[model samples]
Target chain A: MKNSLLSIYNIAKKDLLIELRNKDVILSISGFGTIIIFIFSFAFDVGSSLSSSTAAGILWSSISFASITGINRSFMLESENDTLEALIMAPISRDIIYLGKVVGNFIFITISEMVILPIFAILFNFSILSLEFITCCLLANIGFSVVGTLFASLSIKVRAREVLLPMLFLPCIIPILFSSIEATSMIFQGKGWNDLSIWFQLTVAFNLIFLIFSLFISNVIYED
Target chain B: MSNIIKNKLLTCSAIFMFINLYLIFIWVPTEANQGAIQRILYIHVPVSQISMLAIILVAVSSVLFLWKRNQFWDKIAISAAEIGLLYGTIMLLSGILWAKPVWGVWWTGEAKLTTALILYLIYVSYIMFRNYFPTGSQGQRIAAIIAIIGALDTPLIYFAANLWSEAHPPIVLGPASENDSSFSSNDMRIVWLFSTITFMIFFVYLLRIRYKLQDTISKYLTNT
Candidate 1:
């Protein structure tokens, strides 16, 4: 287990090093997240009758949509550079590769969320810095990252991946989307732990199930 | 051997289906509240159950295919996903038509409805992924991963969607619904039980035929 953790850390570090060099995925995800917020404001007609729930909804929805680009780019870079096979052929068990990717994605999305939340706060006019809201974001980000990584790896070879990833990922992640949004909305509405616990537990369950399940199938996911 | 089994199953389901139609139309009393619109319940509910069952069937078959490295389970997974989409379309259409006069709209983001819609989209994405990914063992492996994740996500989807809406239909056709169903008349209950069983058999019949067709196509592709 120690060796495995080290290998996972190493793989994740590799991803982080590459990302730091270019910052393409992080920049695009944050930019897309901001654009999503703006578009939703138009749809909801900003400043007329917006509620805290609406603010919470905007925040989570942007995160979910923006993270898709990050996911696609993560794998796309490897496949596009012809490095997926080299990584898969490395001296490591397949699950480590899968876990590493999941860890990398989870961090990338969290960083994007940091950039997004403050911008969302200013536009949607919410305090948006409570401990409960931050807790909800972390849980939701983990859920999003795990499922996104699995499908991104699965669809890496598909020709229409740009269109197909969201089509595939959105449906699988709907529960996460719902759970996090509900949790965030309740936090915005001044609901306490009693109400937030249910959504948080659901989000945690979703994350763990996908995390274990995707690991079980990750060997198949990366195989030739 | 396969031909004989499929023929027998098809004949049995057809006879059972005719009897089911008779029972549903002539025997069961029309619900007073929704009137004729509620008759869609007979068609909608059974197909809805089958569509839900298909996700589990596909997921199990997918797991088996990945573990055993066999084409038989792959065939089952493919056929089940395609058949699930067929029933899903019927379920969605019937639900929408029924909802028009009853719910006063064609669609609502209600818990069950949202879950069903998302499940249908997930299956559709699976089919799309299978087609877009190159035809090979790797394709089947990735598809299995998709099925497993989708099945695991099912209950959470309902939970999250439930948080958004409370208006719902009563349970029918099971022990749990014995006292829960609003339409608990003996005739409705009896017909619903029979209809559900018949539709399940029909689902099996279609599954077998589709599996055979997929087998032949794969064999032919491999031969050429």
Candidate 2:
């Protein structure tokens, strides 16, 4: 188990380094994300008084789209180098590879979200310093990234990888979107975290279940 | 000779489906409030039920394919997914038609309908995902893994619809739900049950023909 964790850590670190050097994964996503936020701002003329209530939807939409770009690039890059096959051929377990990629993708998406959230808050004039808002976003972020990573690995080998990822991903991320919006909205409404415990529970359950199932399925797919 | 027999069976099932539709439209008693529009339930509910069953079959058979690594199980799963898509499409069409008159809108954020749509899209993407890989070259294993992970999204979509505040109520039993008691009177029950049986028989019959068709296509395509 220790060896597995160490292997995954090394793999994830290597992935991070590669991503840092290229930076296309992050820049393109954040660029596209910025455009989406501008569209939202122009489309909805709530003025400078845009309610914090609307922030949740905007935040999630931006993150979801940015994550897709990130996921697409992550696998596309790996495949470019034939790195995926090499990792599979190595002595490492398939689940460890899955874990490494999922964690790596999760971190990349988190950074994108970290950038987008504050910008969204500033442009829309919504408060973002609340602990509740941050926590809700984090849980939903993990859930989306977990499921997205699994699908990214699944999608990369497909003929229409870019088009297929969002088609396969959007529906699956609906739950995360729901919980995130609800929890964040509650916070915006001045309700405490305790009020949104059910959403949090749902988020956690979704994360755990997808983690286990994706691990198993990734293993089977890798073996092939 | 076997192919001819299978084609005949398919033709017979189509005839049965046509007769069932006639009974639903012309013979079945209409509701007091919803009137003739309620007649749509006879077809819509059953198709939706069978679609869910078809997807479950795909999921389970995919798991079997992964476990046994057998082409036969993969074929079964592919067949089931194809049939599932058929039913899913029918369900979506009938659902939209029914929703237009009842809800005063074509589509709403109803829990059941939204999730059903999401489920349909997920499986459709699965089929599309299958096209990415080369056939008979570990494609089955990759497809199976995808089908399984993709199928996992269905239940979460369903539960999310229930747990989150949504316009549509949870479907507890049958396709309409116990909440739809007003719609599920004894008169409705009889026709609905008949429609369910008709759809299931039609589904099985269609699945068998599809599997045979797939066998032929695969044989010809692979030049085996």
Computed on alpha carbons, the lDDT of every model, listed in order, comes to 0.84, 0.78
Superposed by TM-score, candidate 1 places the C-alpha of residue B44 at a distance from the truth, in angstroms, of: 1.5
Worst 10 residues of 2 chain B by lDDT: B170-179
Give per-residue CA lDDT, model 1, range B1-224, as digits (tens). 87788889999999999999898888788875556656677888999989888888899999888789889999999999999999999999998787666656677676888889988898899999999999888788888888877887788888878865642243233222233243657778778889899999999999988988999999999998
Q: Write out the backbone clash pairs for model 1.
A: none
Question: Per-residue lDDT for A79-175 in model 2, tens only?
Answer: 8888889999988888899899888887887777777877787788777788887778778778877888887776656777888889888878888
RMSD of 2: 3.3
Q: Write the per-residue lDDT of candidate 2 for residues B1-224, one digit (tens) a residue.
A: 87787777777778878878888888777776656777878888898899899888988988887777776777788898999899889888988787676656677666777788888888888888787666764667767876776677667777777766452243233223323543546767877888898888878887887787888888897886
Candidate 1 per-residue C-alpha lDDT over A142-188 given as tens digits, one digit per residue, 9 for 90 to 100? 88888888888888888899999999888888877777777777777
Model 2 alpha-carbon drift over 4 Å, by segment: A46-48, A51-53, B1-8, B166-179, B182-187
- Clash-forming residue pairs, model 2: none
How far in Å is the alpha carbon of B93 misplaced in model 1? 1.1
Which has the greatest TM-score? Answer: 2
Model 1 has how many clashing residue pairs? 0
